[model samples]
Target: MTLGLTGLLALGLATSVLAQDYQRPSISGIGAVAQPEQIAAWDIDVRPDGLGLPVGKGTAEDGEALFADRCAMCHGDFGEGVGRWPVLTGGHGSLTEERPEKTVGSYWPYTSTLFDYIYRAMPYGDAKTLSPDEVYALSAYILAENQIVEYDQELNQDNFAQIEMPNRANFFADDRAVSEAYSERCMSGCKAEDINIVSAAPELDVTPEE
Candidate 1:
């Protein structure tokens, strides 16, 4: 009886020790591996209403010079995109058509978006190397070529945001979520046959099946 009690106590103690040994590391949450500050450098983006434009100034004349040297190789001397790159100017009233060839001047809702896009990702090969002044100048030249602004006008932090775009009110946010809630909720009698199969493909058909 004494030996059995001793064995049982030893087994219980071993089980308790094993249970105590099972431990997880202190750091295991999503935030444990996430570095918040590392993303700041890669998160540069400018919004409409000139929310994120850095402080700088550039004239259309200066922009023309810079564009000729750096941008013209790809964008052409007149802001017309090379062979298949894209066209920057024109396309004023084509947005109403079925297939509108949108450009910087015609399709862009805000002028600031142009400066933001070019400043962050232009010159194709070398990006984020242009100074604030150079970015402003490049923006000015492109805008001039698009005929949105005059060649002599100066684009700075103050006036760049104020430049009104032709398509400022052309864009509308997703109204289906807010305005079309009734339409989405009116599917009481579900009709699978009535669904438009022409508009939406079911899945990728790899095989030639009828």
Candidate 2:
């Protein structure tokens, strides 16, 4: 059977309707359709504006204890990073160095990132096992260790958006207006910029050599 574009579209629509009618899909042997609760469990999206933060509050002091107990084995007692593990603090003036050490305080541009990452992926082997309150505590502790937040301050969804990252001011809008070619080119006299010769084929070299 030869299927034209219209036939192919009809086939796709029929397949969609079949998928809707049947709870389980069997074409590729995907046996189950996710329930709303299942989808919610996996659909964790932390917005940059801190809108999707869960209802939970915690303090840096509370976070320090949690971090020491749950995270220190991999992250170190002070967020200095365990041996061969990720470092989460310091490196404030190292971006210009030959081998820059980018820590959470020195490079990350948002407070939400700290909350989101630790909530989703942390404690090395265990991921997404921390409760919302525990995640908030861990987030606050890391922020305090990196000197972004006071060790006594409580962090929650209400105040999370107010927390500013140290690298926030460094990022500016990318404006390539001057770099773009918007008008007709002056092929000769205006061509003063550096030009790299990308390839050379001796047989295809048609220009006269001076």
Candidate 3:
């Protein structure tokens, strides 16, 4: 009886293990991702060399109103940035430094990413609420603030990509020795030992008011 019980327990455990090992079907519905034909719904992007820019125009003067109403709350009136929000301009000479050097004029690579990021997410609370015309106007205003485009210059899908960023040339492909070092070794001699200590500095003492 004990032997029979042991065999039954082992069989049950093996069955449970087999059941747990079963893999579920990986098939997903077609609607899980946007179809290629749906590109027309939200494919607004202004690429460099002016490839995918749309048609519609906005002058810097026209953009100022849009900026004040939609952007100045977070980016400040002159694009200086508020709190932790991004600064839209400046950082002219910070590229060579090790600190967090950034600005729309200094850090953005592609101009298309700007139009896409803002069009998809902007105005803090209301996104996709800006019409294409409003987006073009706001983009024009921001570009002028960054000094990438002239104040009188007009921007639209036609000329949006022509506005070259100041720090566009700052970035280059990473072809350093570090890229090849990982492939040559795995466990030993992959890197150097830690050289710097990161202990916290002593806090300043403050006396309570009498």
Candidate 4:
């Protein structure tokens, strides 16, 4: 097609704009490097060995009121969970049952996970708002509710690693690499038996009809 004067000018302008965008100098110093203190603020992960636990202490007694105030709406008074929310207590020795009730006391392999999770995320809409002491208190309360710790027993960084989960022995490192069966990749003519279709989608009445 023959280009009109206006079309030619528009095309030239677009090409020039594209060329300018491609050749534009990169921006410099848009943001400063993060300071050590600033990086420390976000590096708040607590390890299984209680390495990153902050200096603080609290008891289940202190946590009960805090739980009611900050967490009861969804978690219930005793951590039985409200509606569809997660149940935090009970479910002991139920792992072998047909339907296991996995709770903190029942299935969690580490207590550090509980503390870390509560600290990083909790209180529904508001996350990371709880203080270190408050987090300890909440952890203690949940532990107490699960009968893992006494109600008045204080929890701190020093003794936190000593508290073990009931299901800790059940969990182990993945051994699929060594334990599971591995074989060479198979393509065509791998199976000795002939393949047969058990049923069709139409016969099973699973396909939607127009």
Model 3 global lDDT (CA atoms, 0 to 1): 0.77
Error of 4 at 139 (Å): 0.4
Local distance difference test, each candidate: 0.80, 0.85, 0.77, 0.92
Better of 2 and 4 by TM-score: 4
Residues 1-210, model 1: lDDT tens digits: 256988999988877746567886685555554466775666667776777777889888998878888878777888777888778888889988997878888888788788877878877888888988998888888888878888889898888988888887888878897766664455477675776556434466555767
Clashing pairs in 3: 53-157, 54-157
What 10-residue stretch in candidate 3 is worst by lDDT?
200-209
Model 3 C-alpha lDDT per residue in residues 1-210, reported as the tens digit of each score: 256988989988877746677888786875566788788776766556766566677877888987887899899887888898879877767877888558877788767777777778888789878776777788878778878888888777766786677677768888777666655446777558875857545444354646
State candidate 3's TM-score: 0.66
Clashing pairs in 4: none
User: TM-score for all predictions?
Assistant: 0.66, 0.65, 0.66, 0.71
lDDT of 4: 0.92
Q: What is the lDDT of residue 194 in candidate 4?
A: 85
Runs in model 3 lying further than 4 Å from the true structure:
1-37, 98-100, 176-198, 201-210
Tell how far residue 28 is off in model 1, in angstroms. 8.9
Best by TM-score: 4
Decide which is better by TM-score, 2 or 3: 3
Best by lDDT: 4
Question: Candidate 1 versus the native: TM-score?
Answer: 0.66
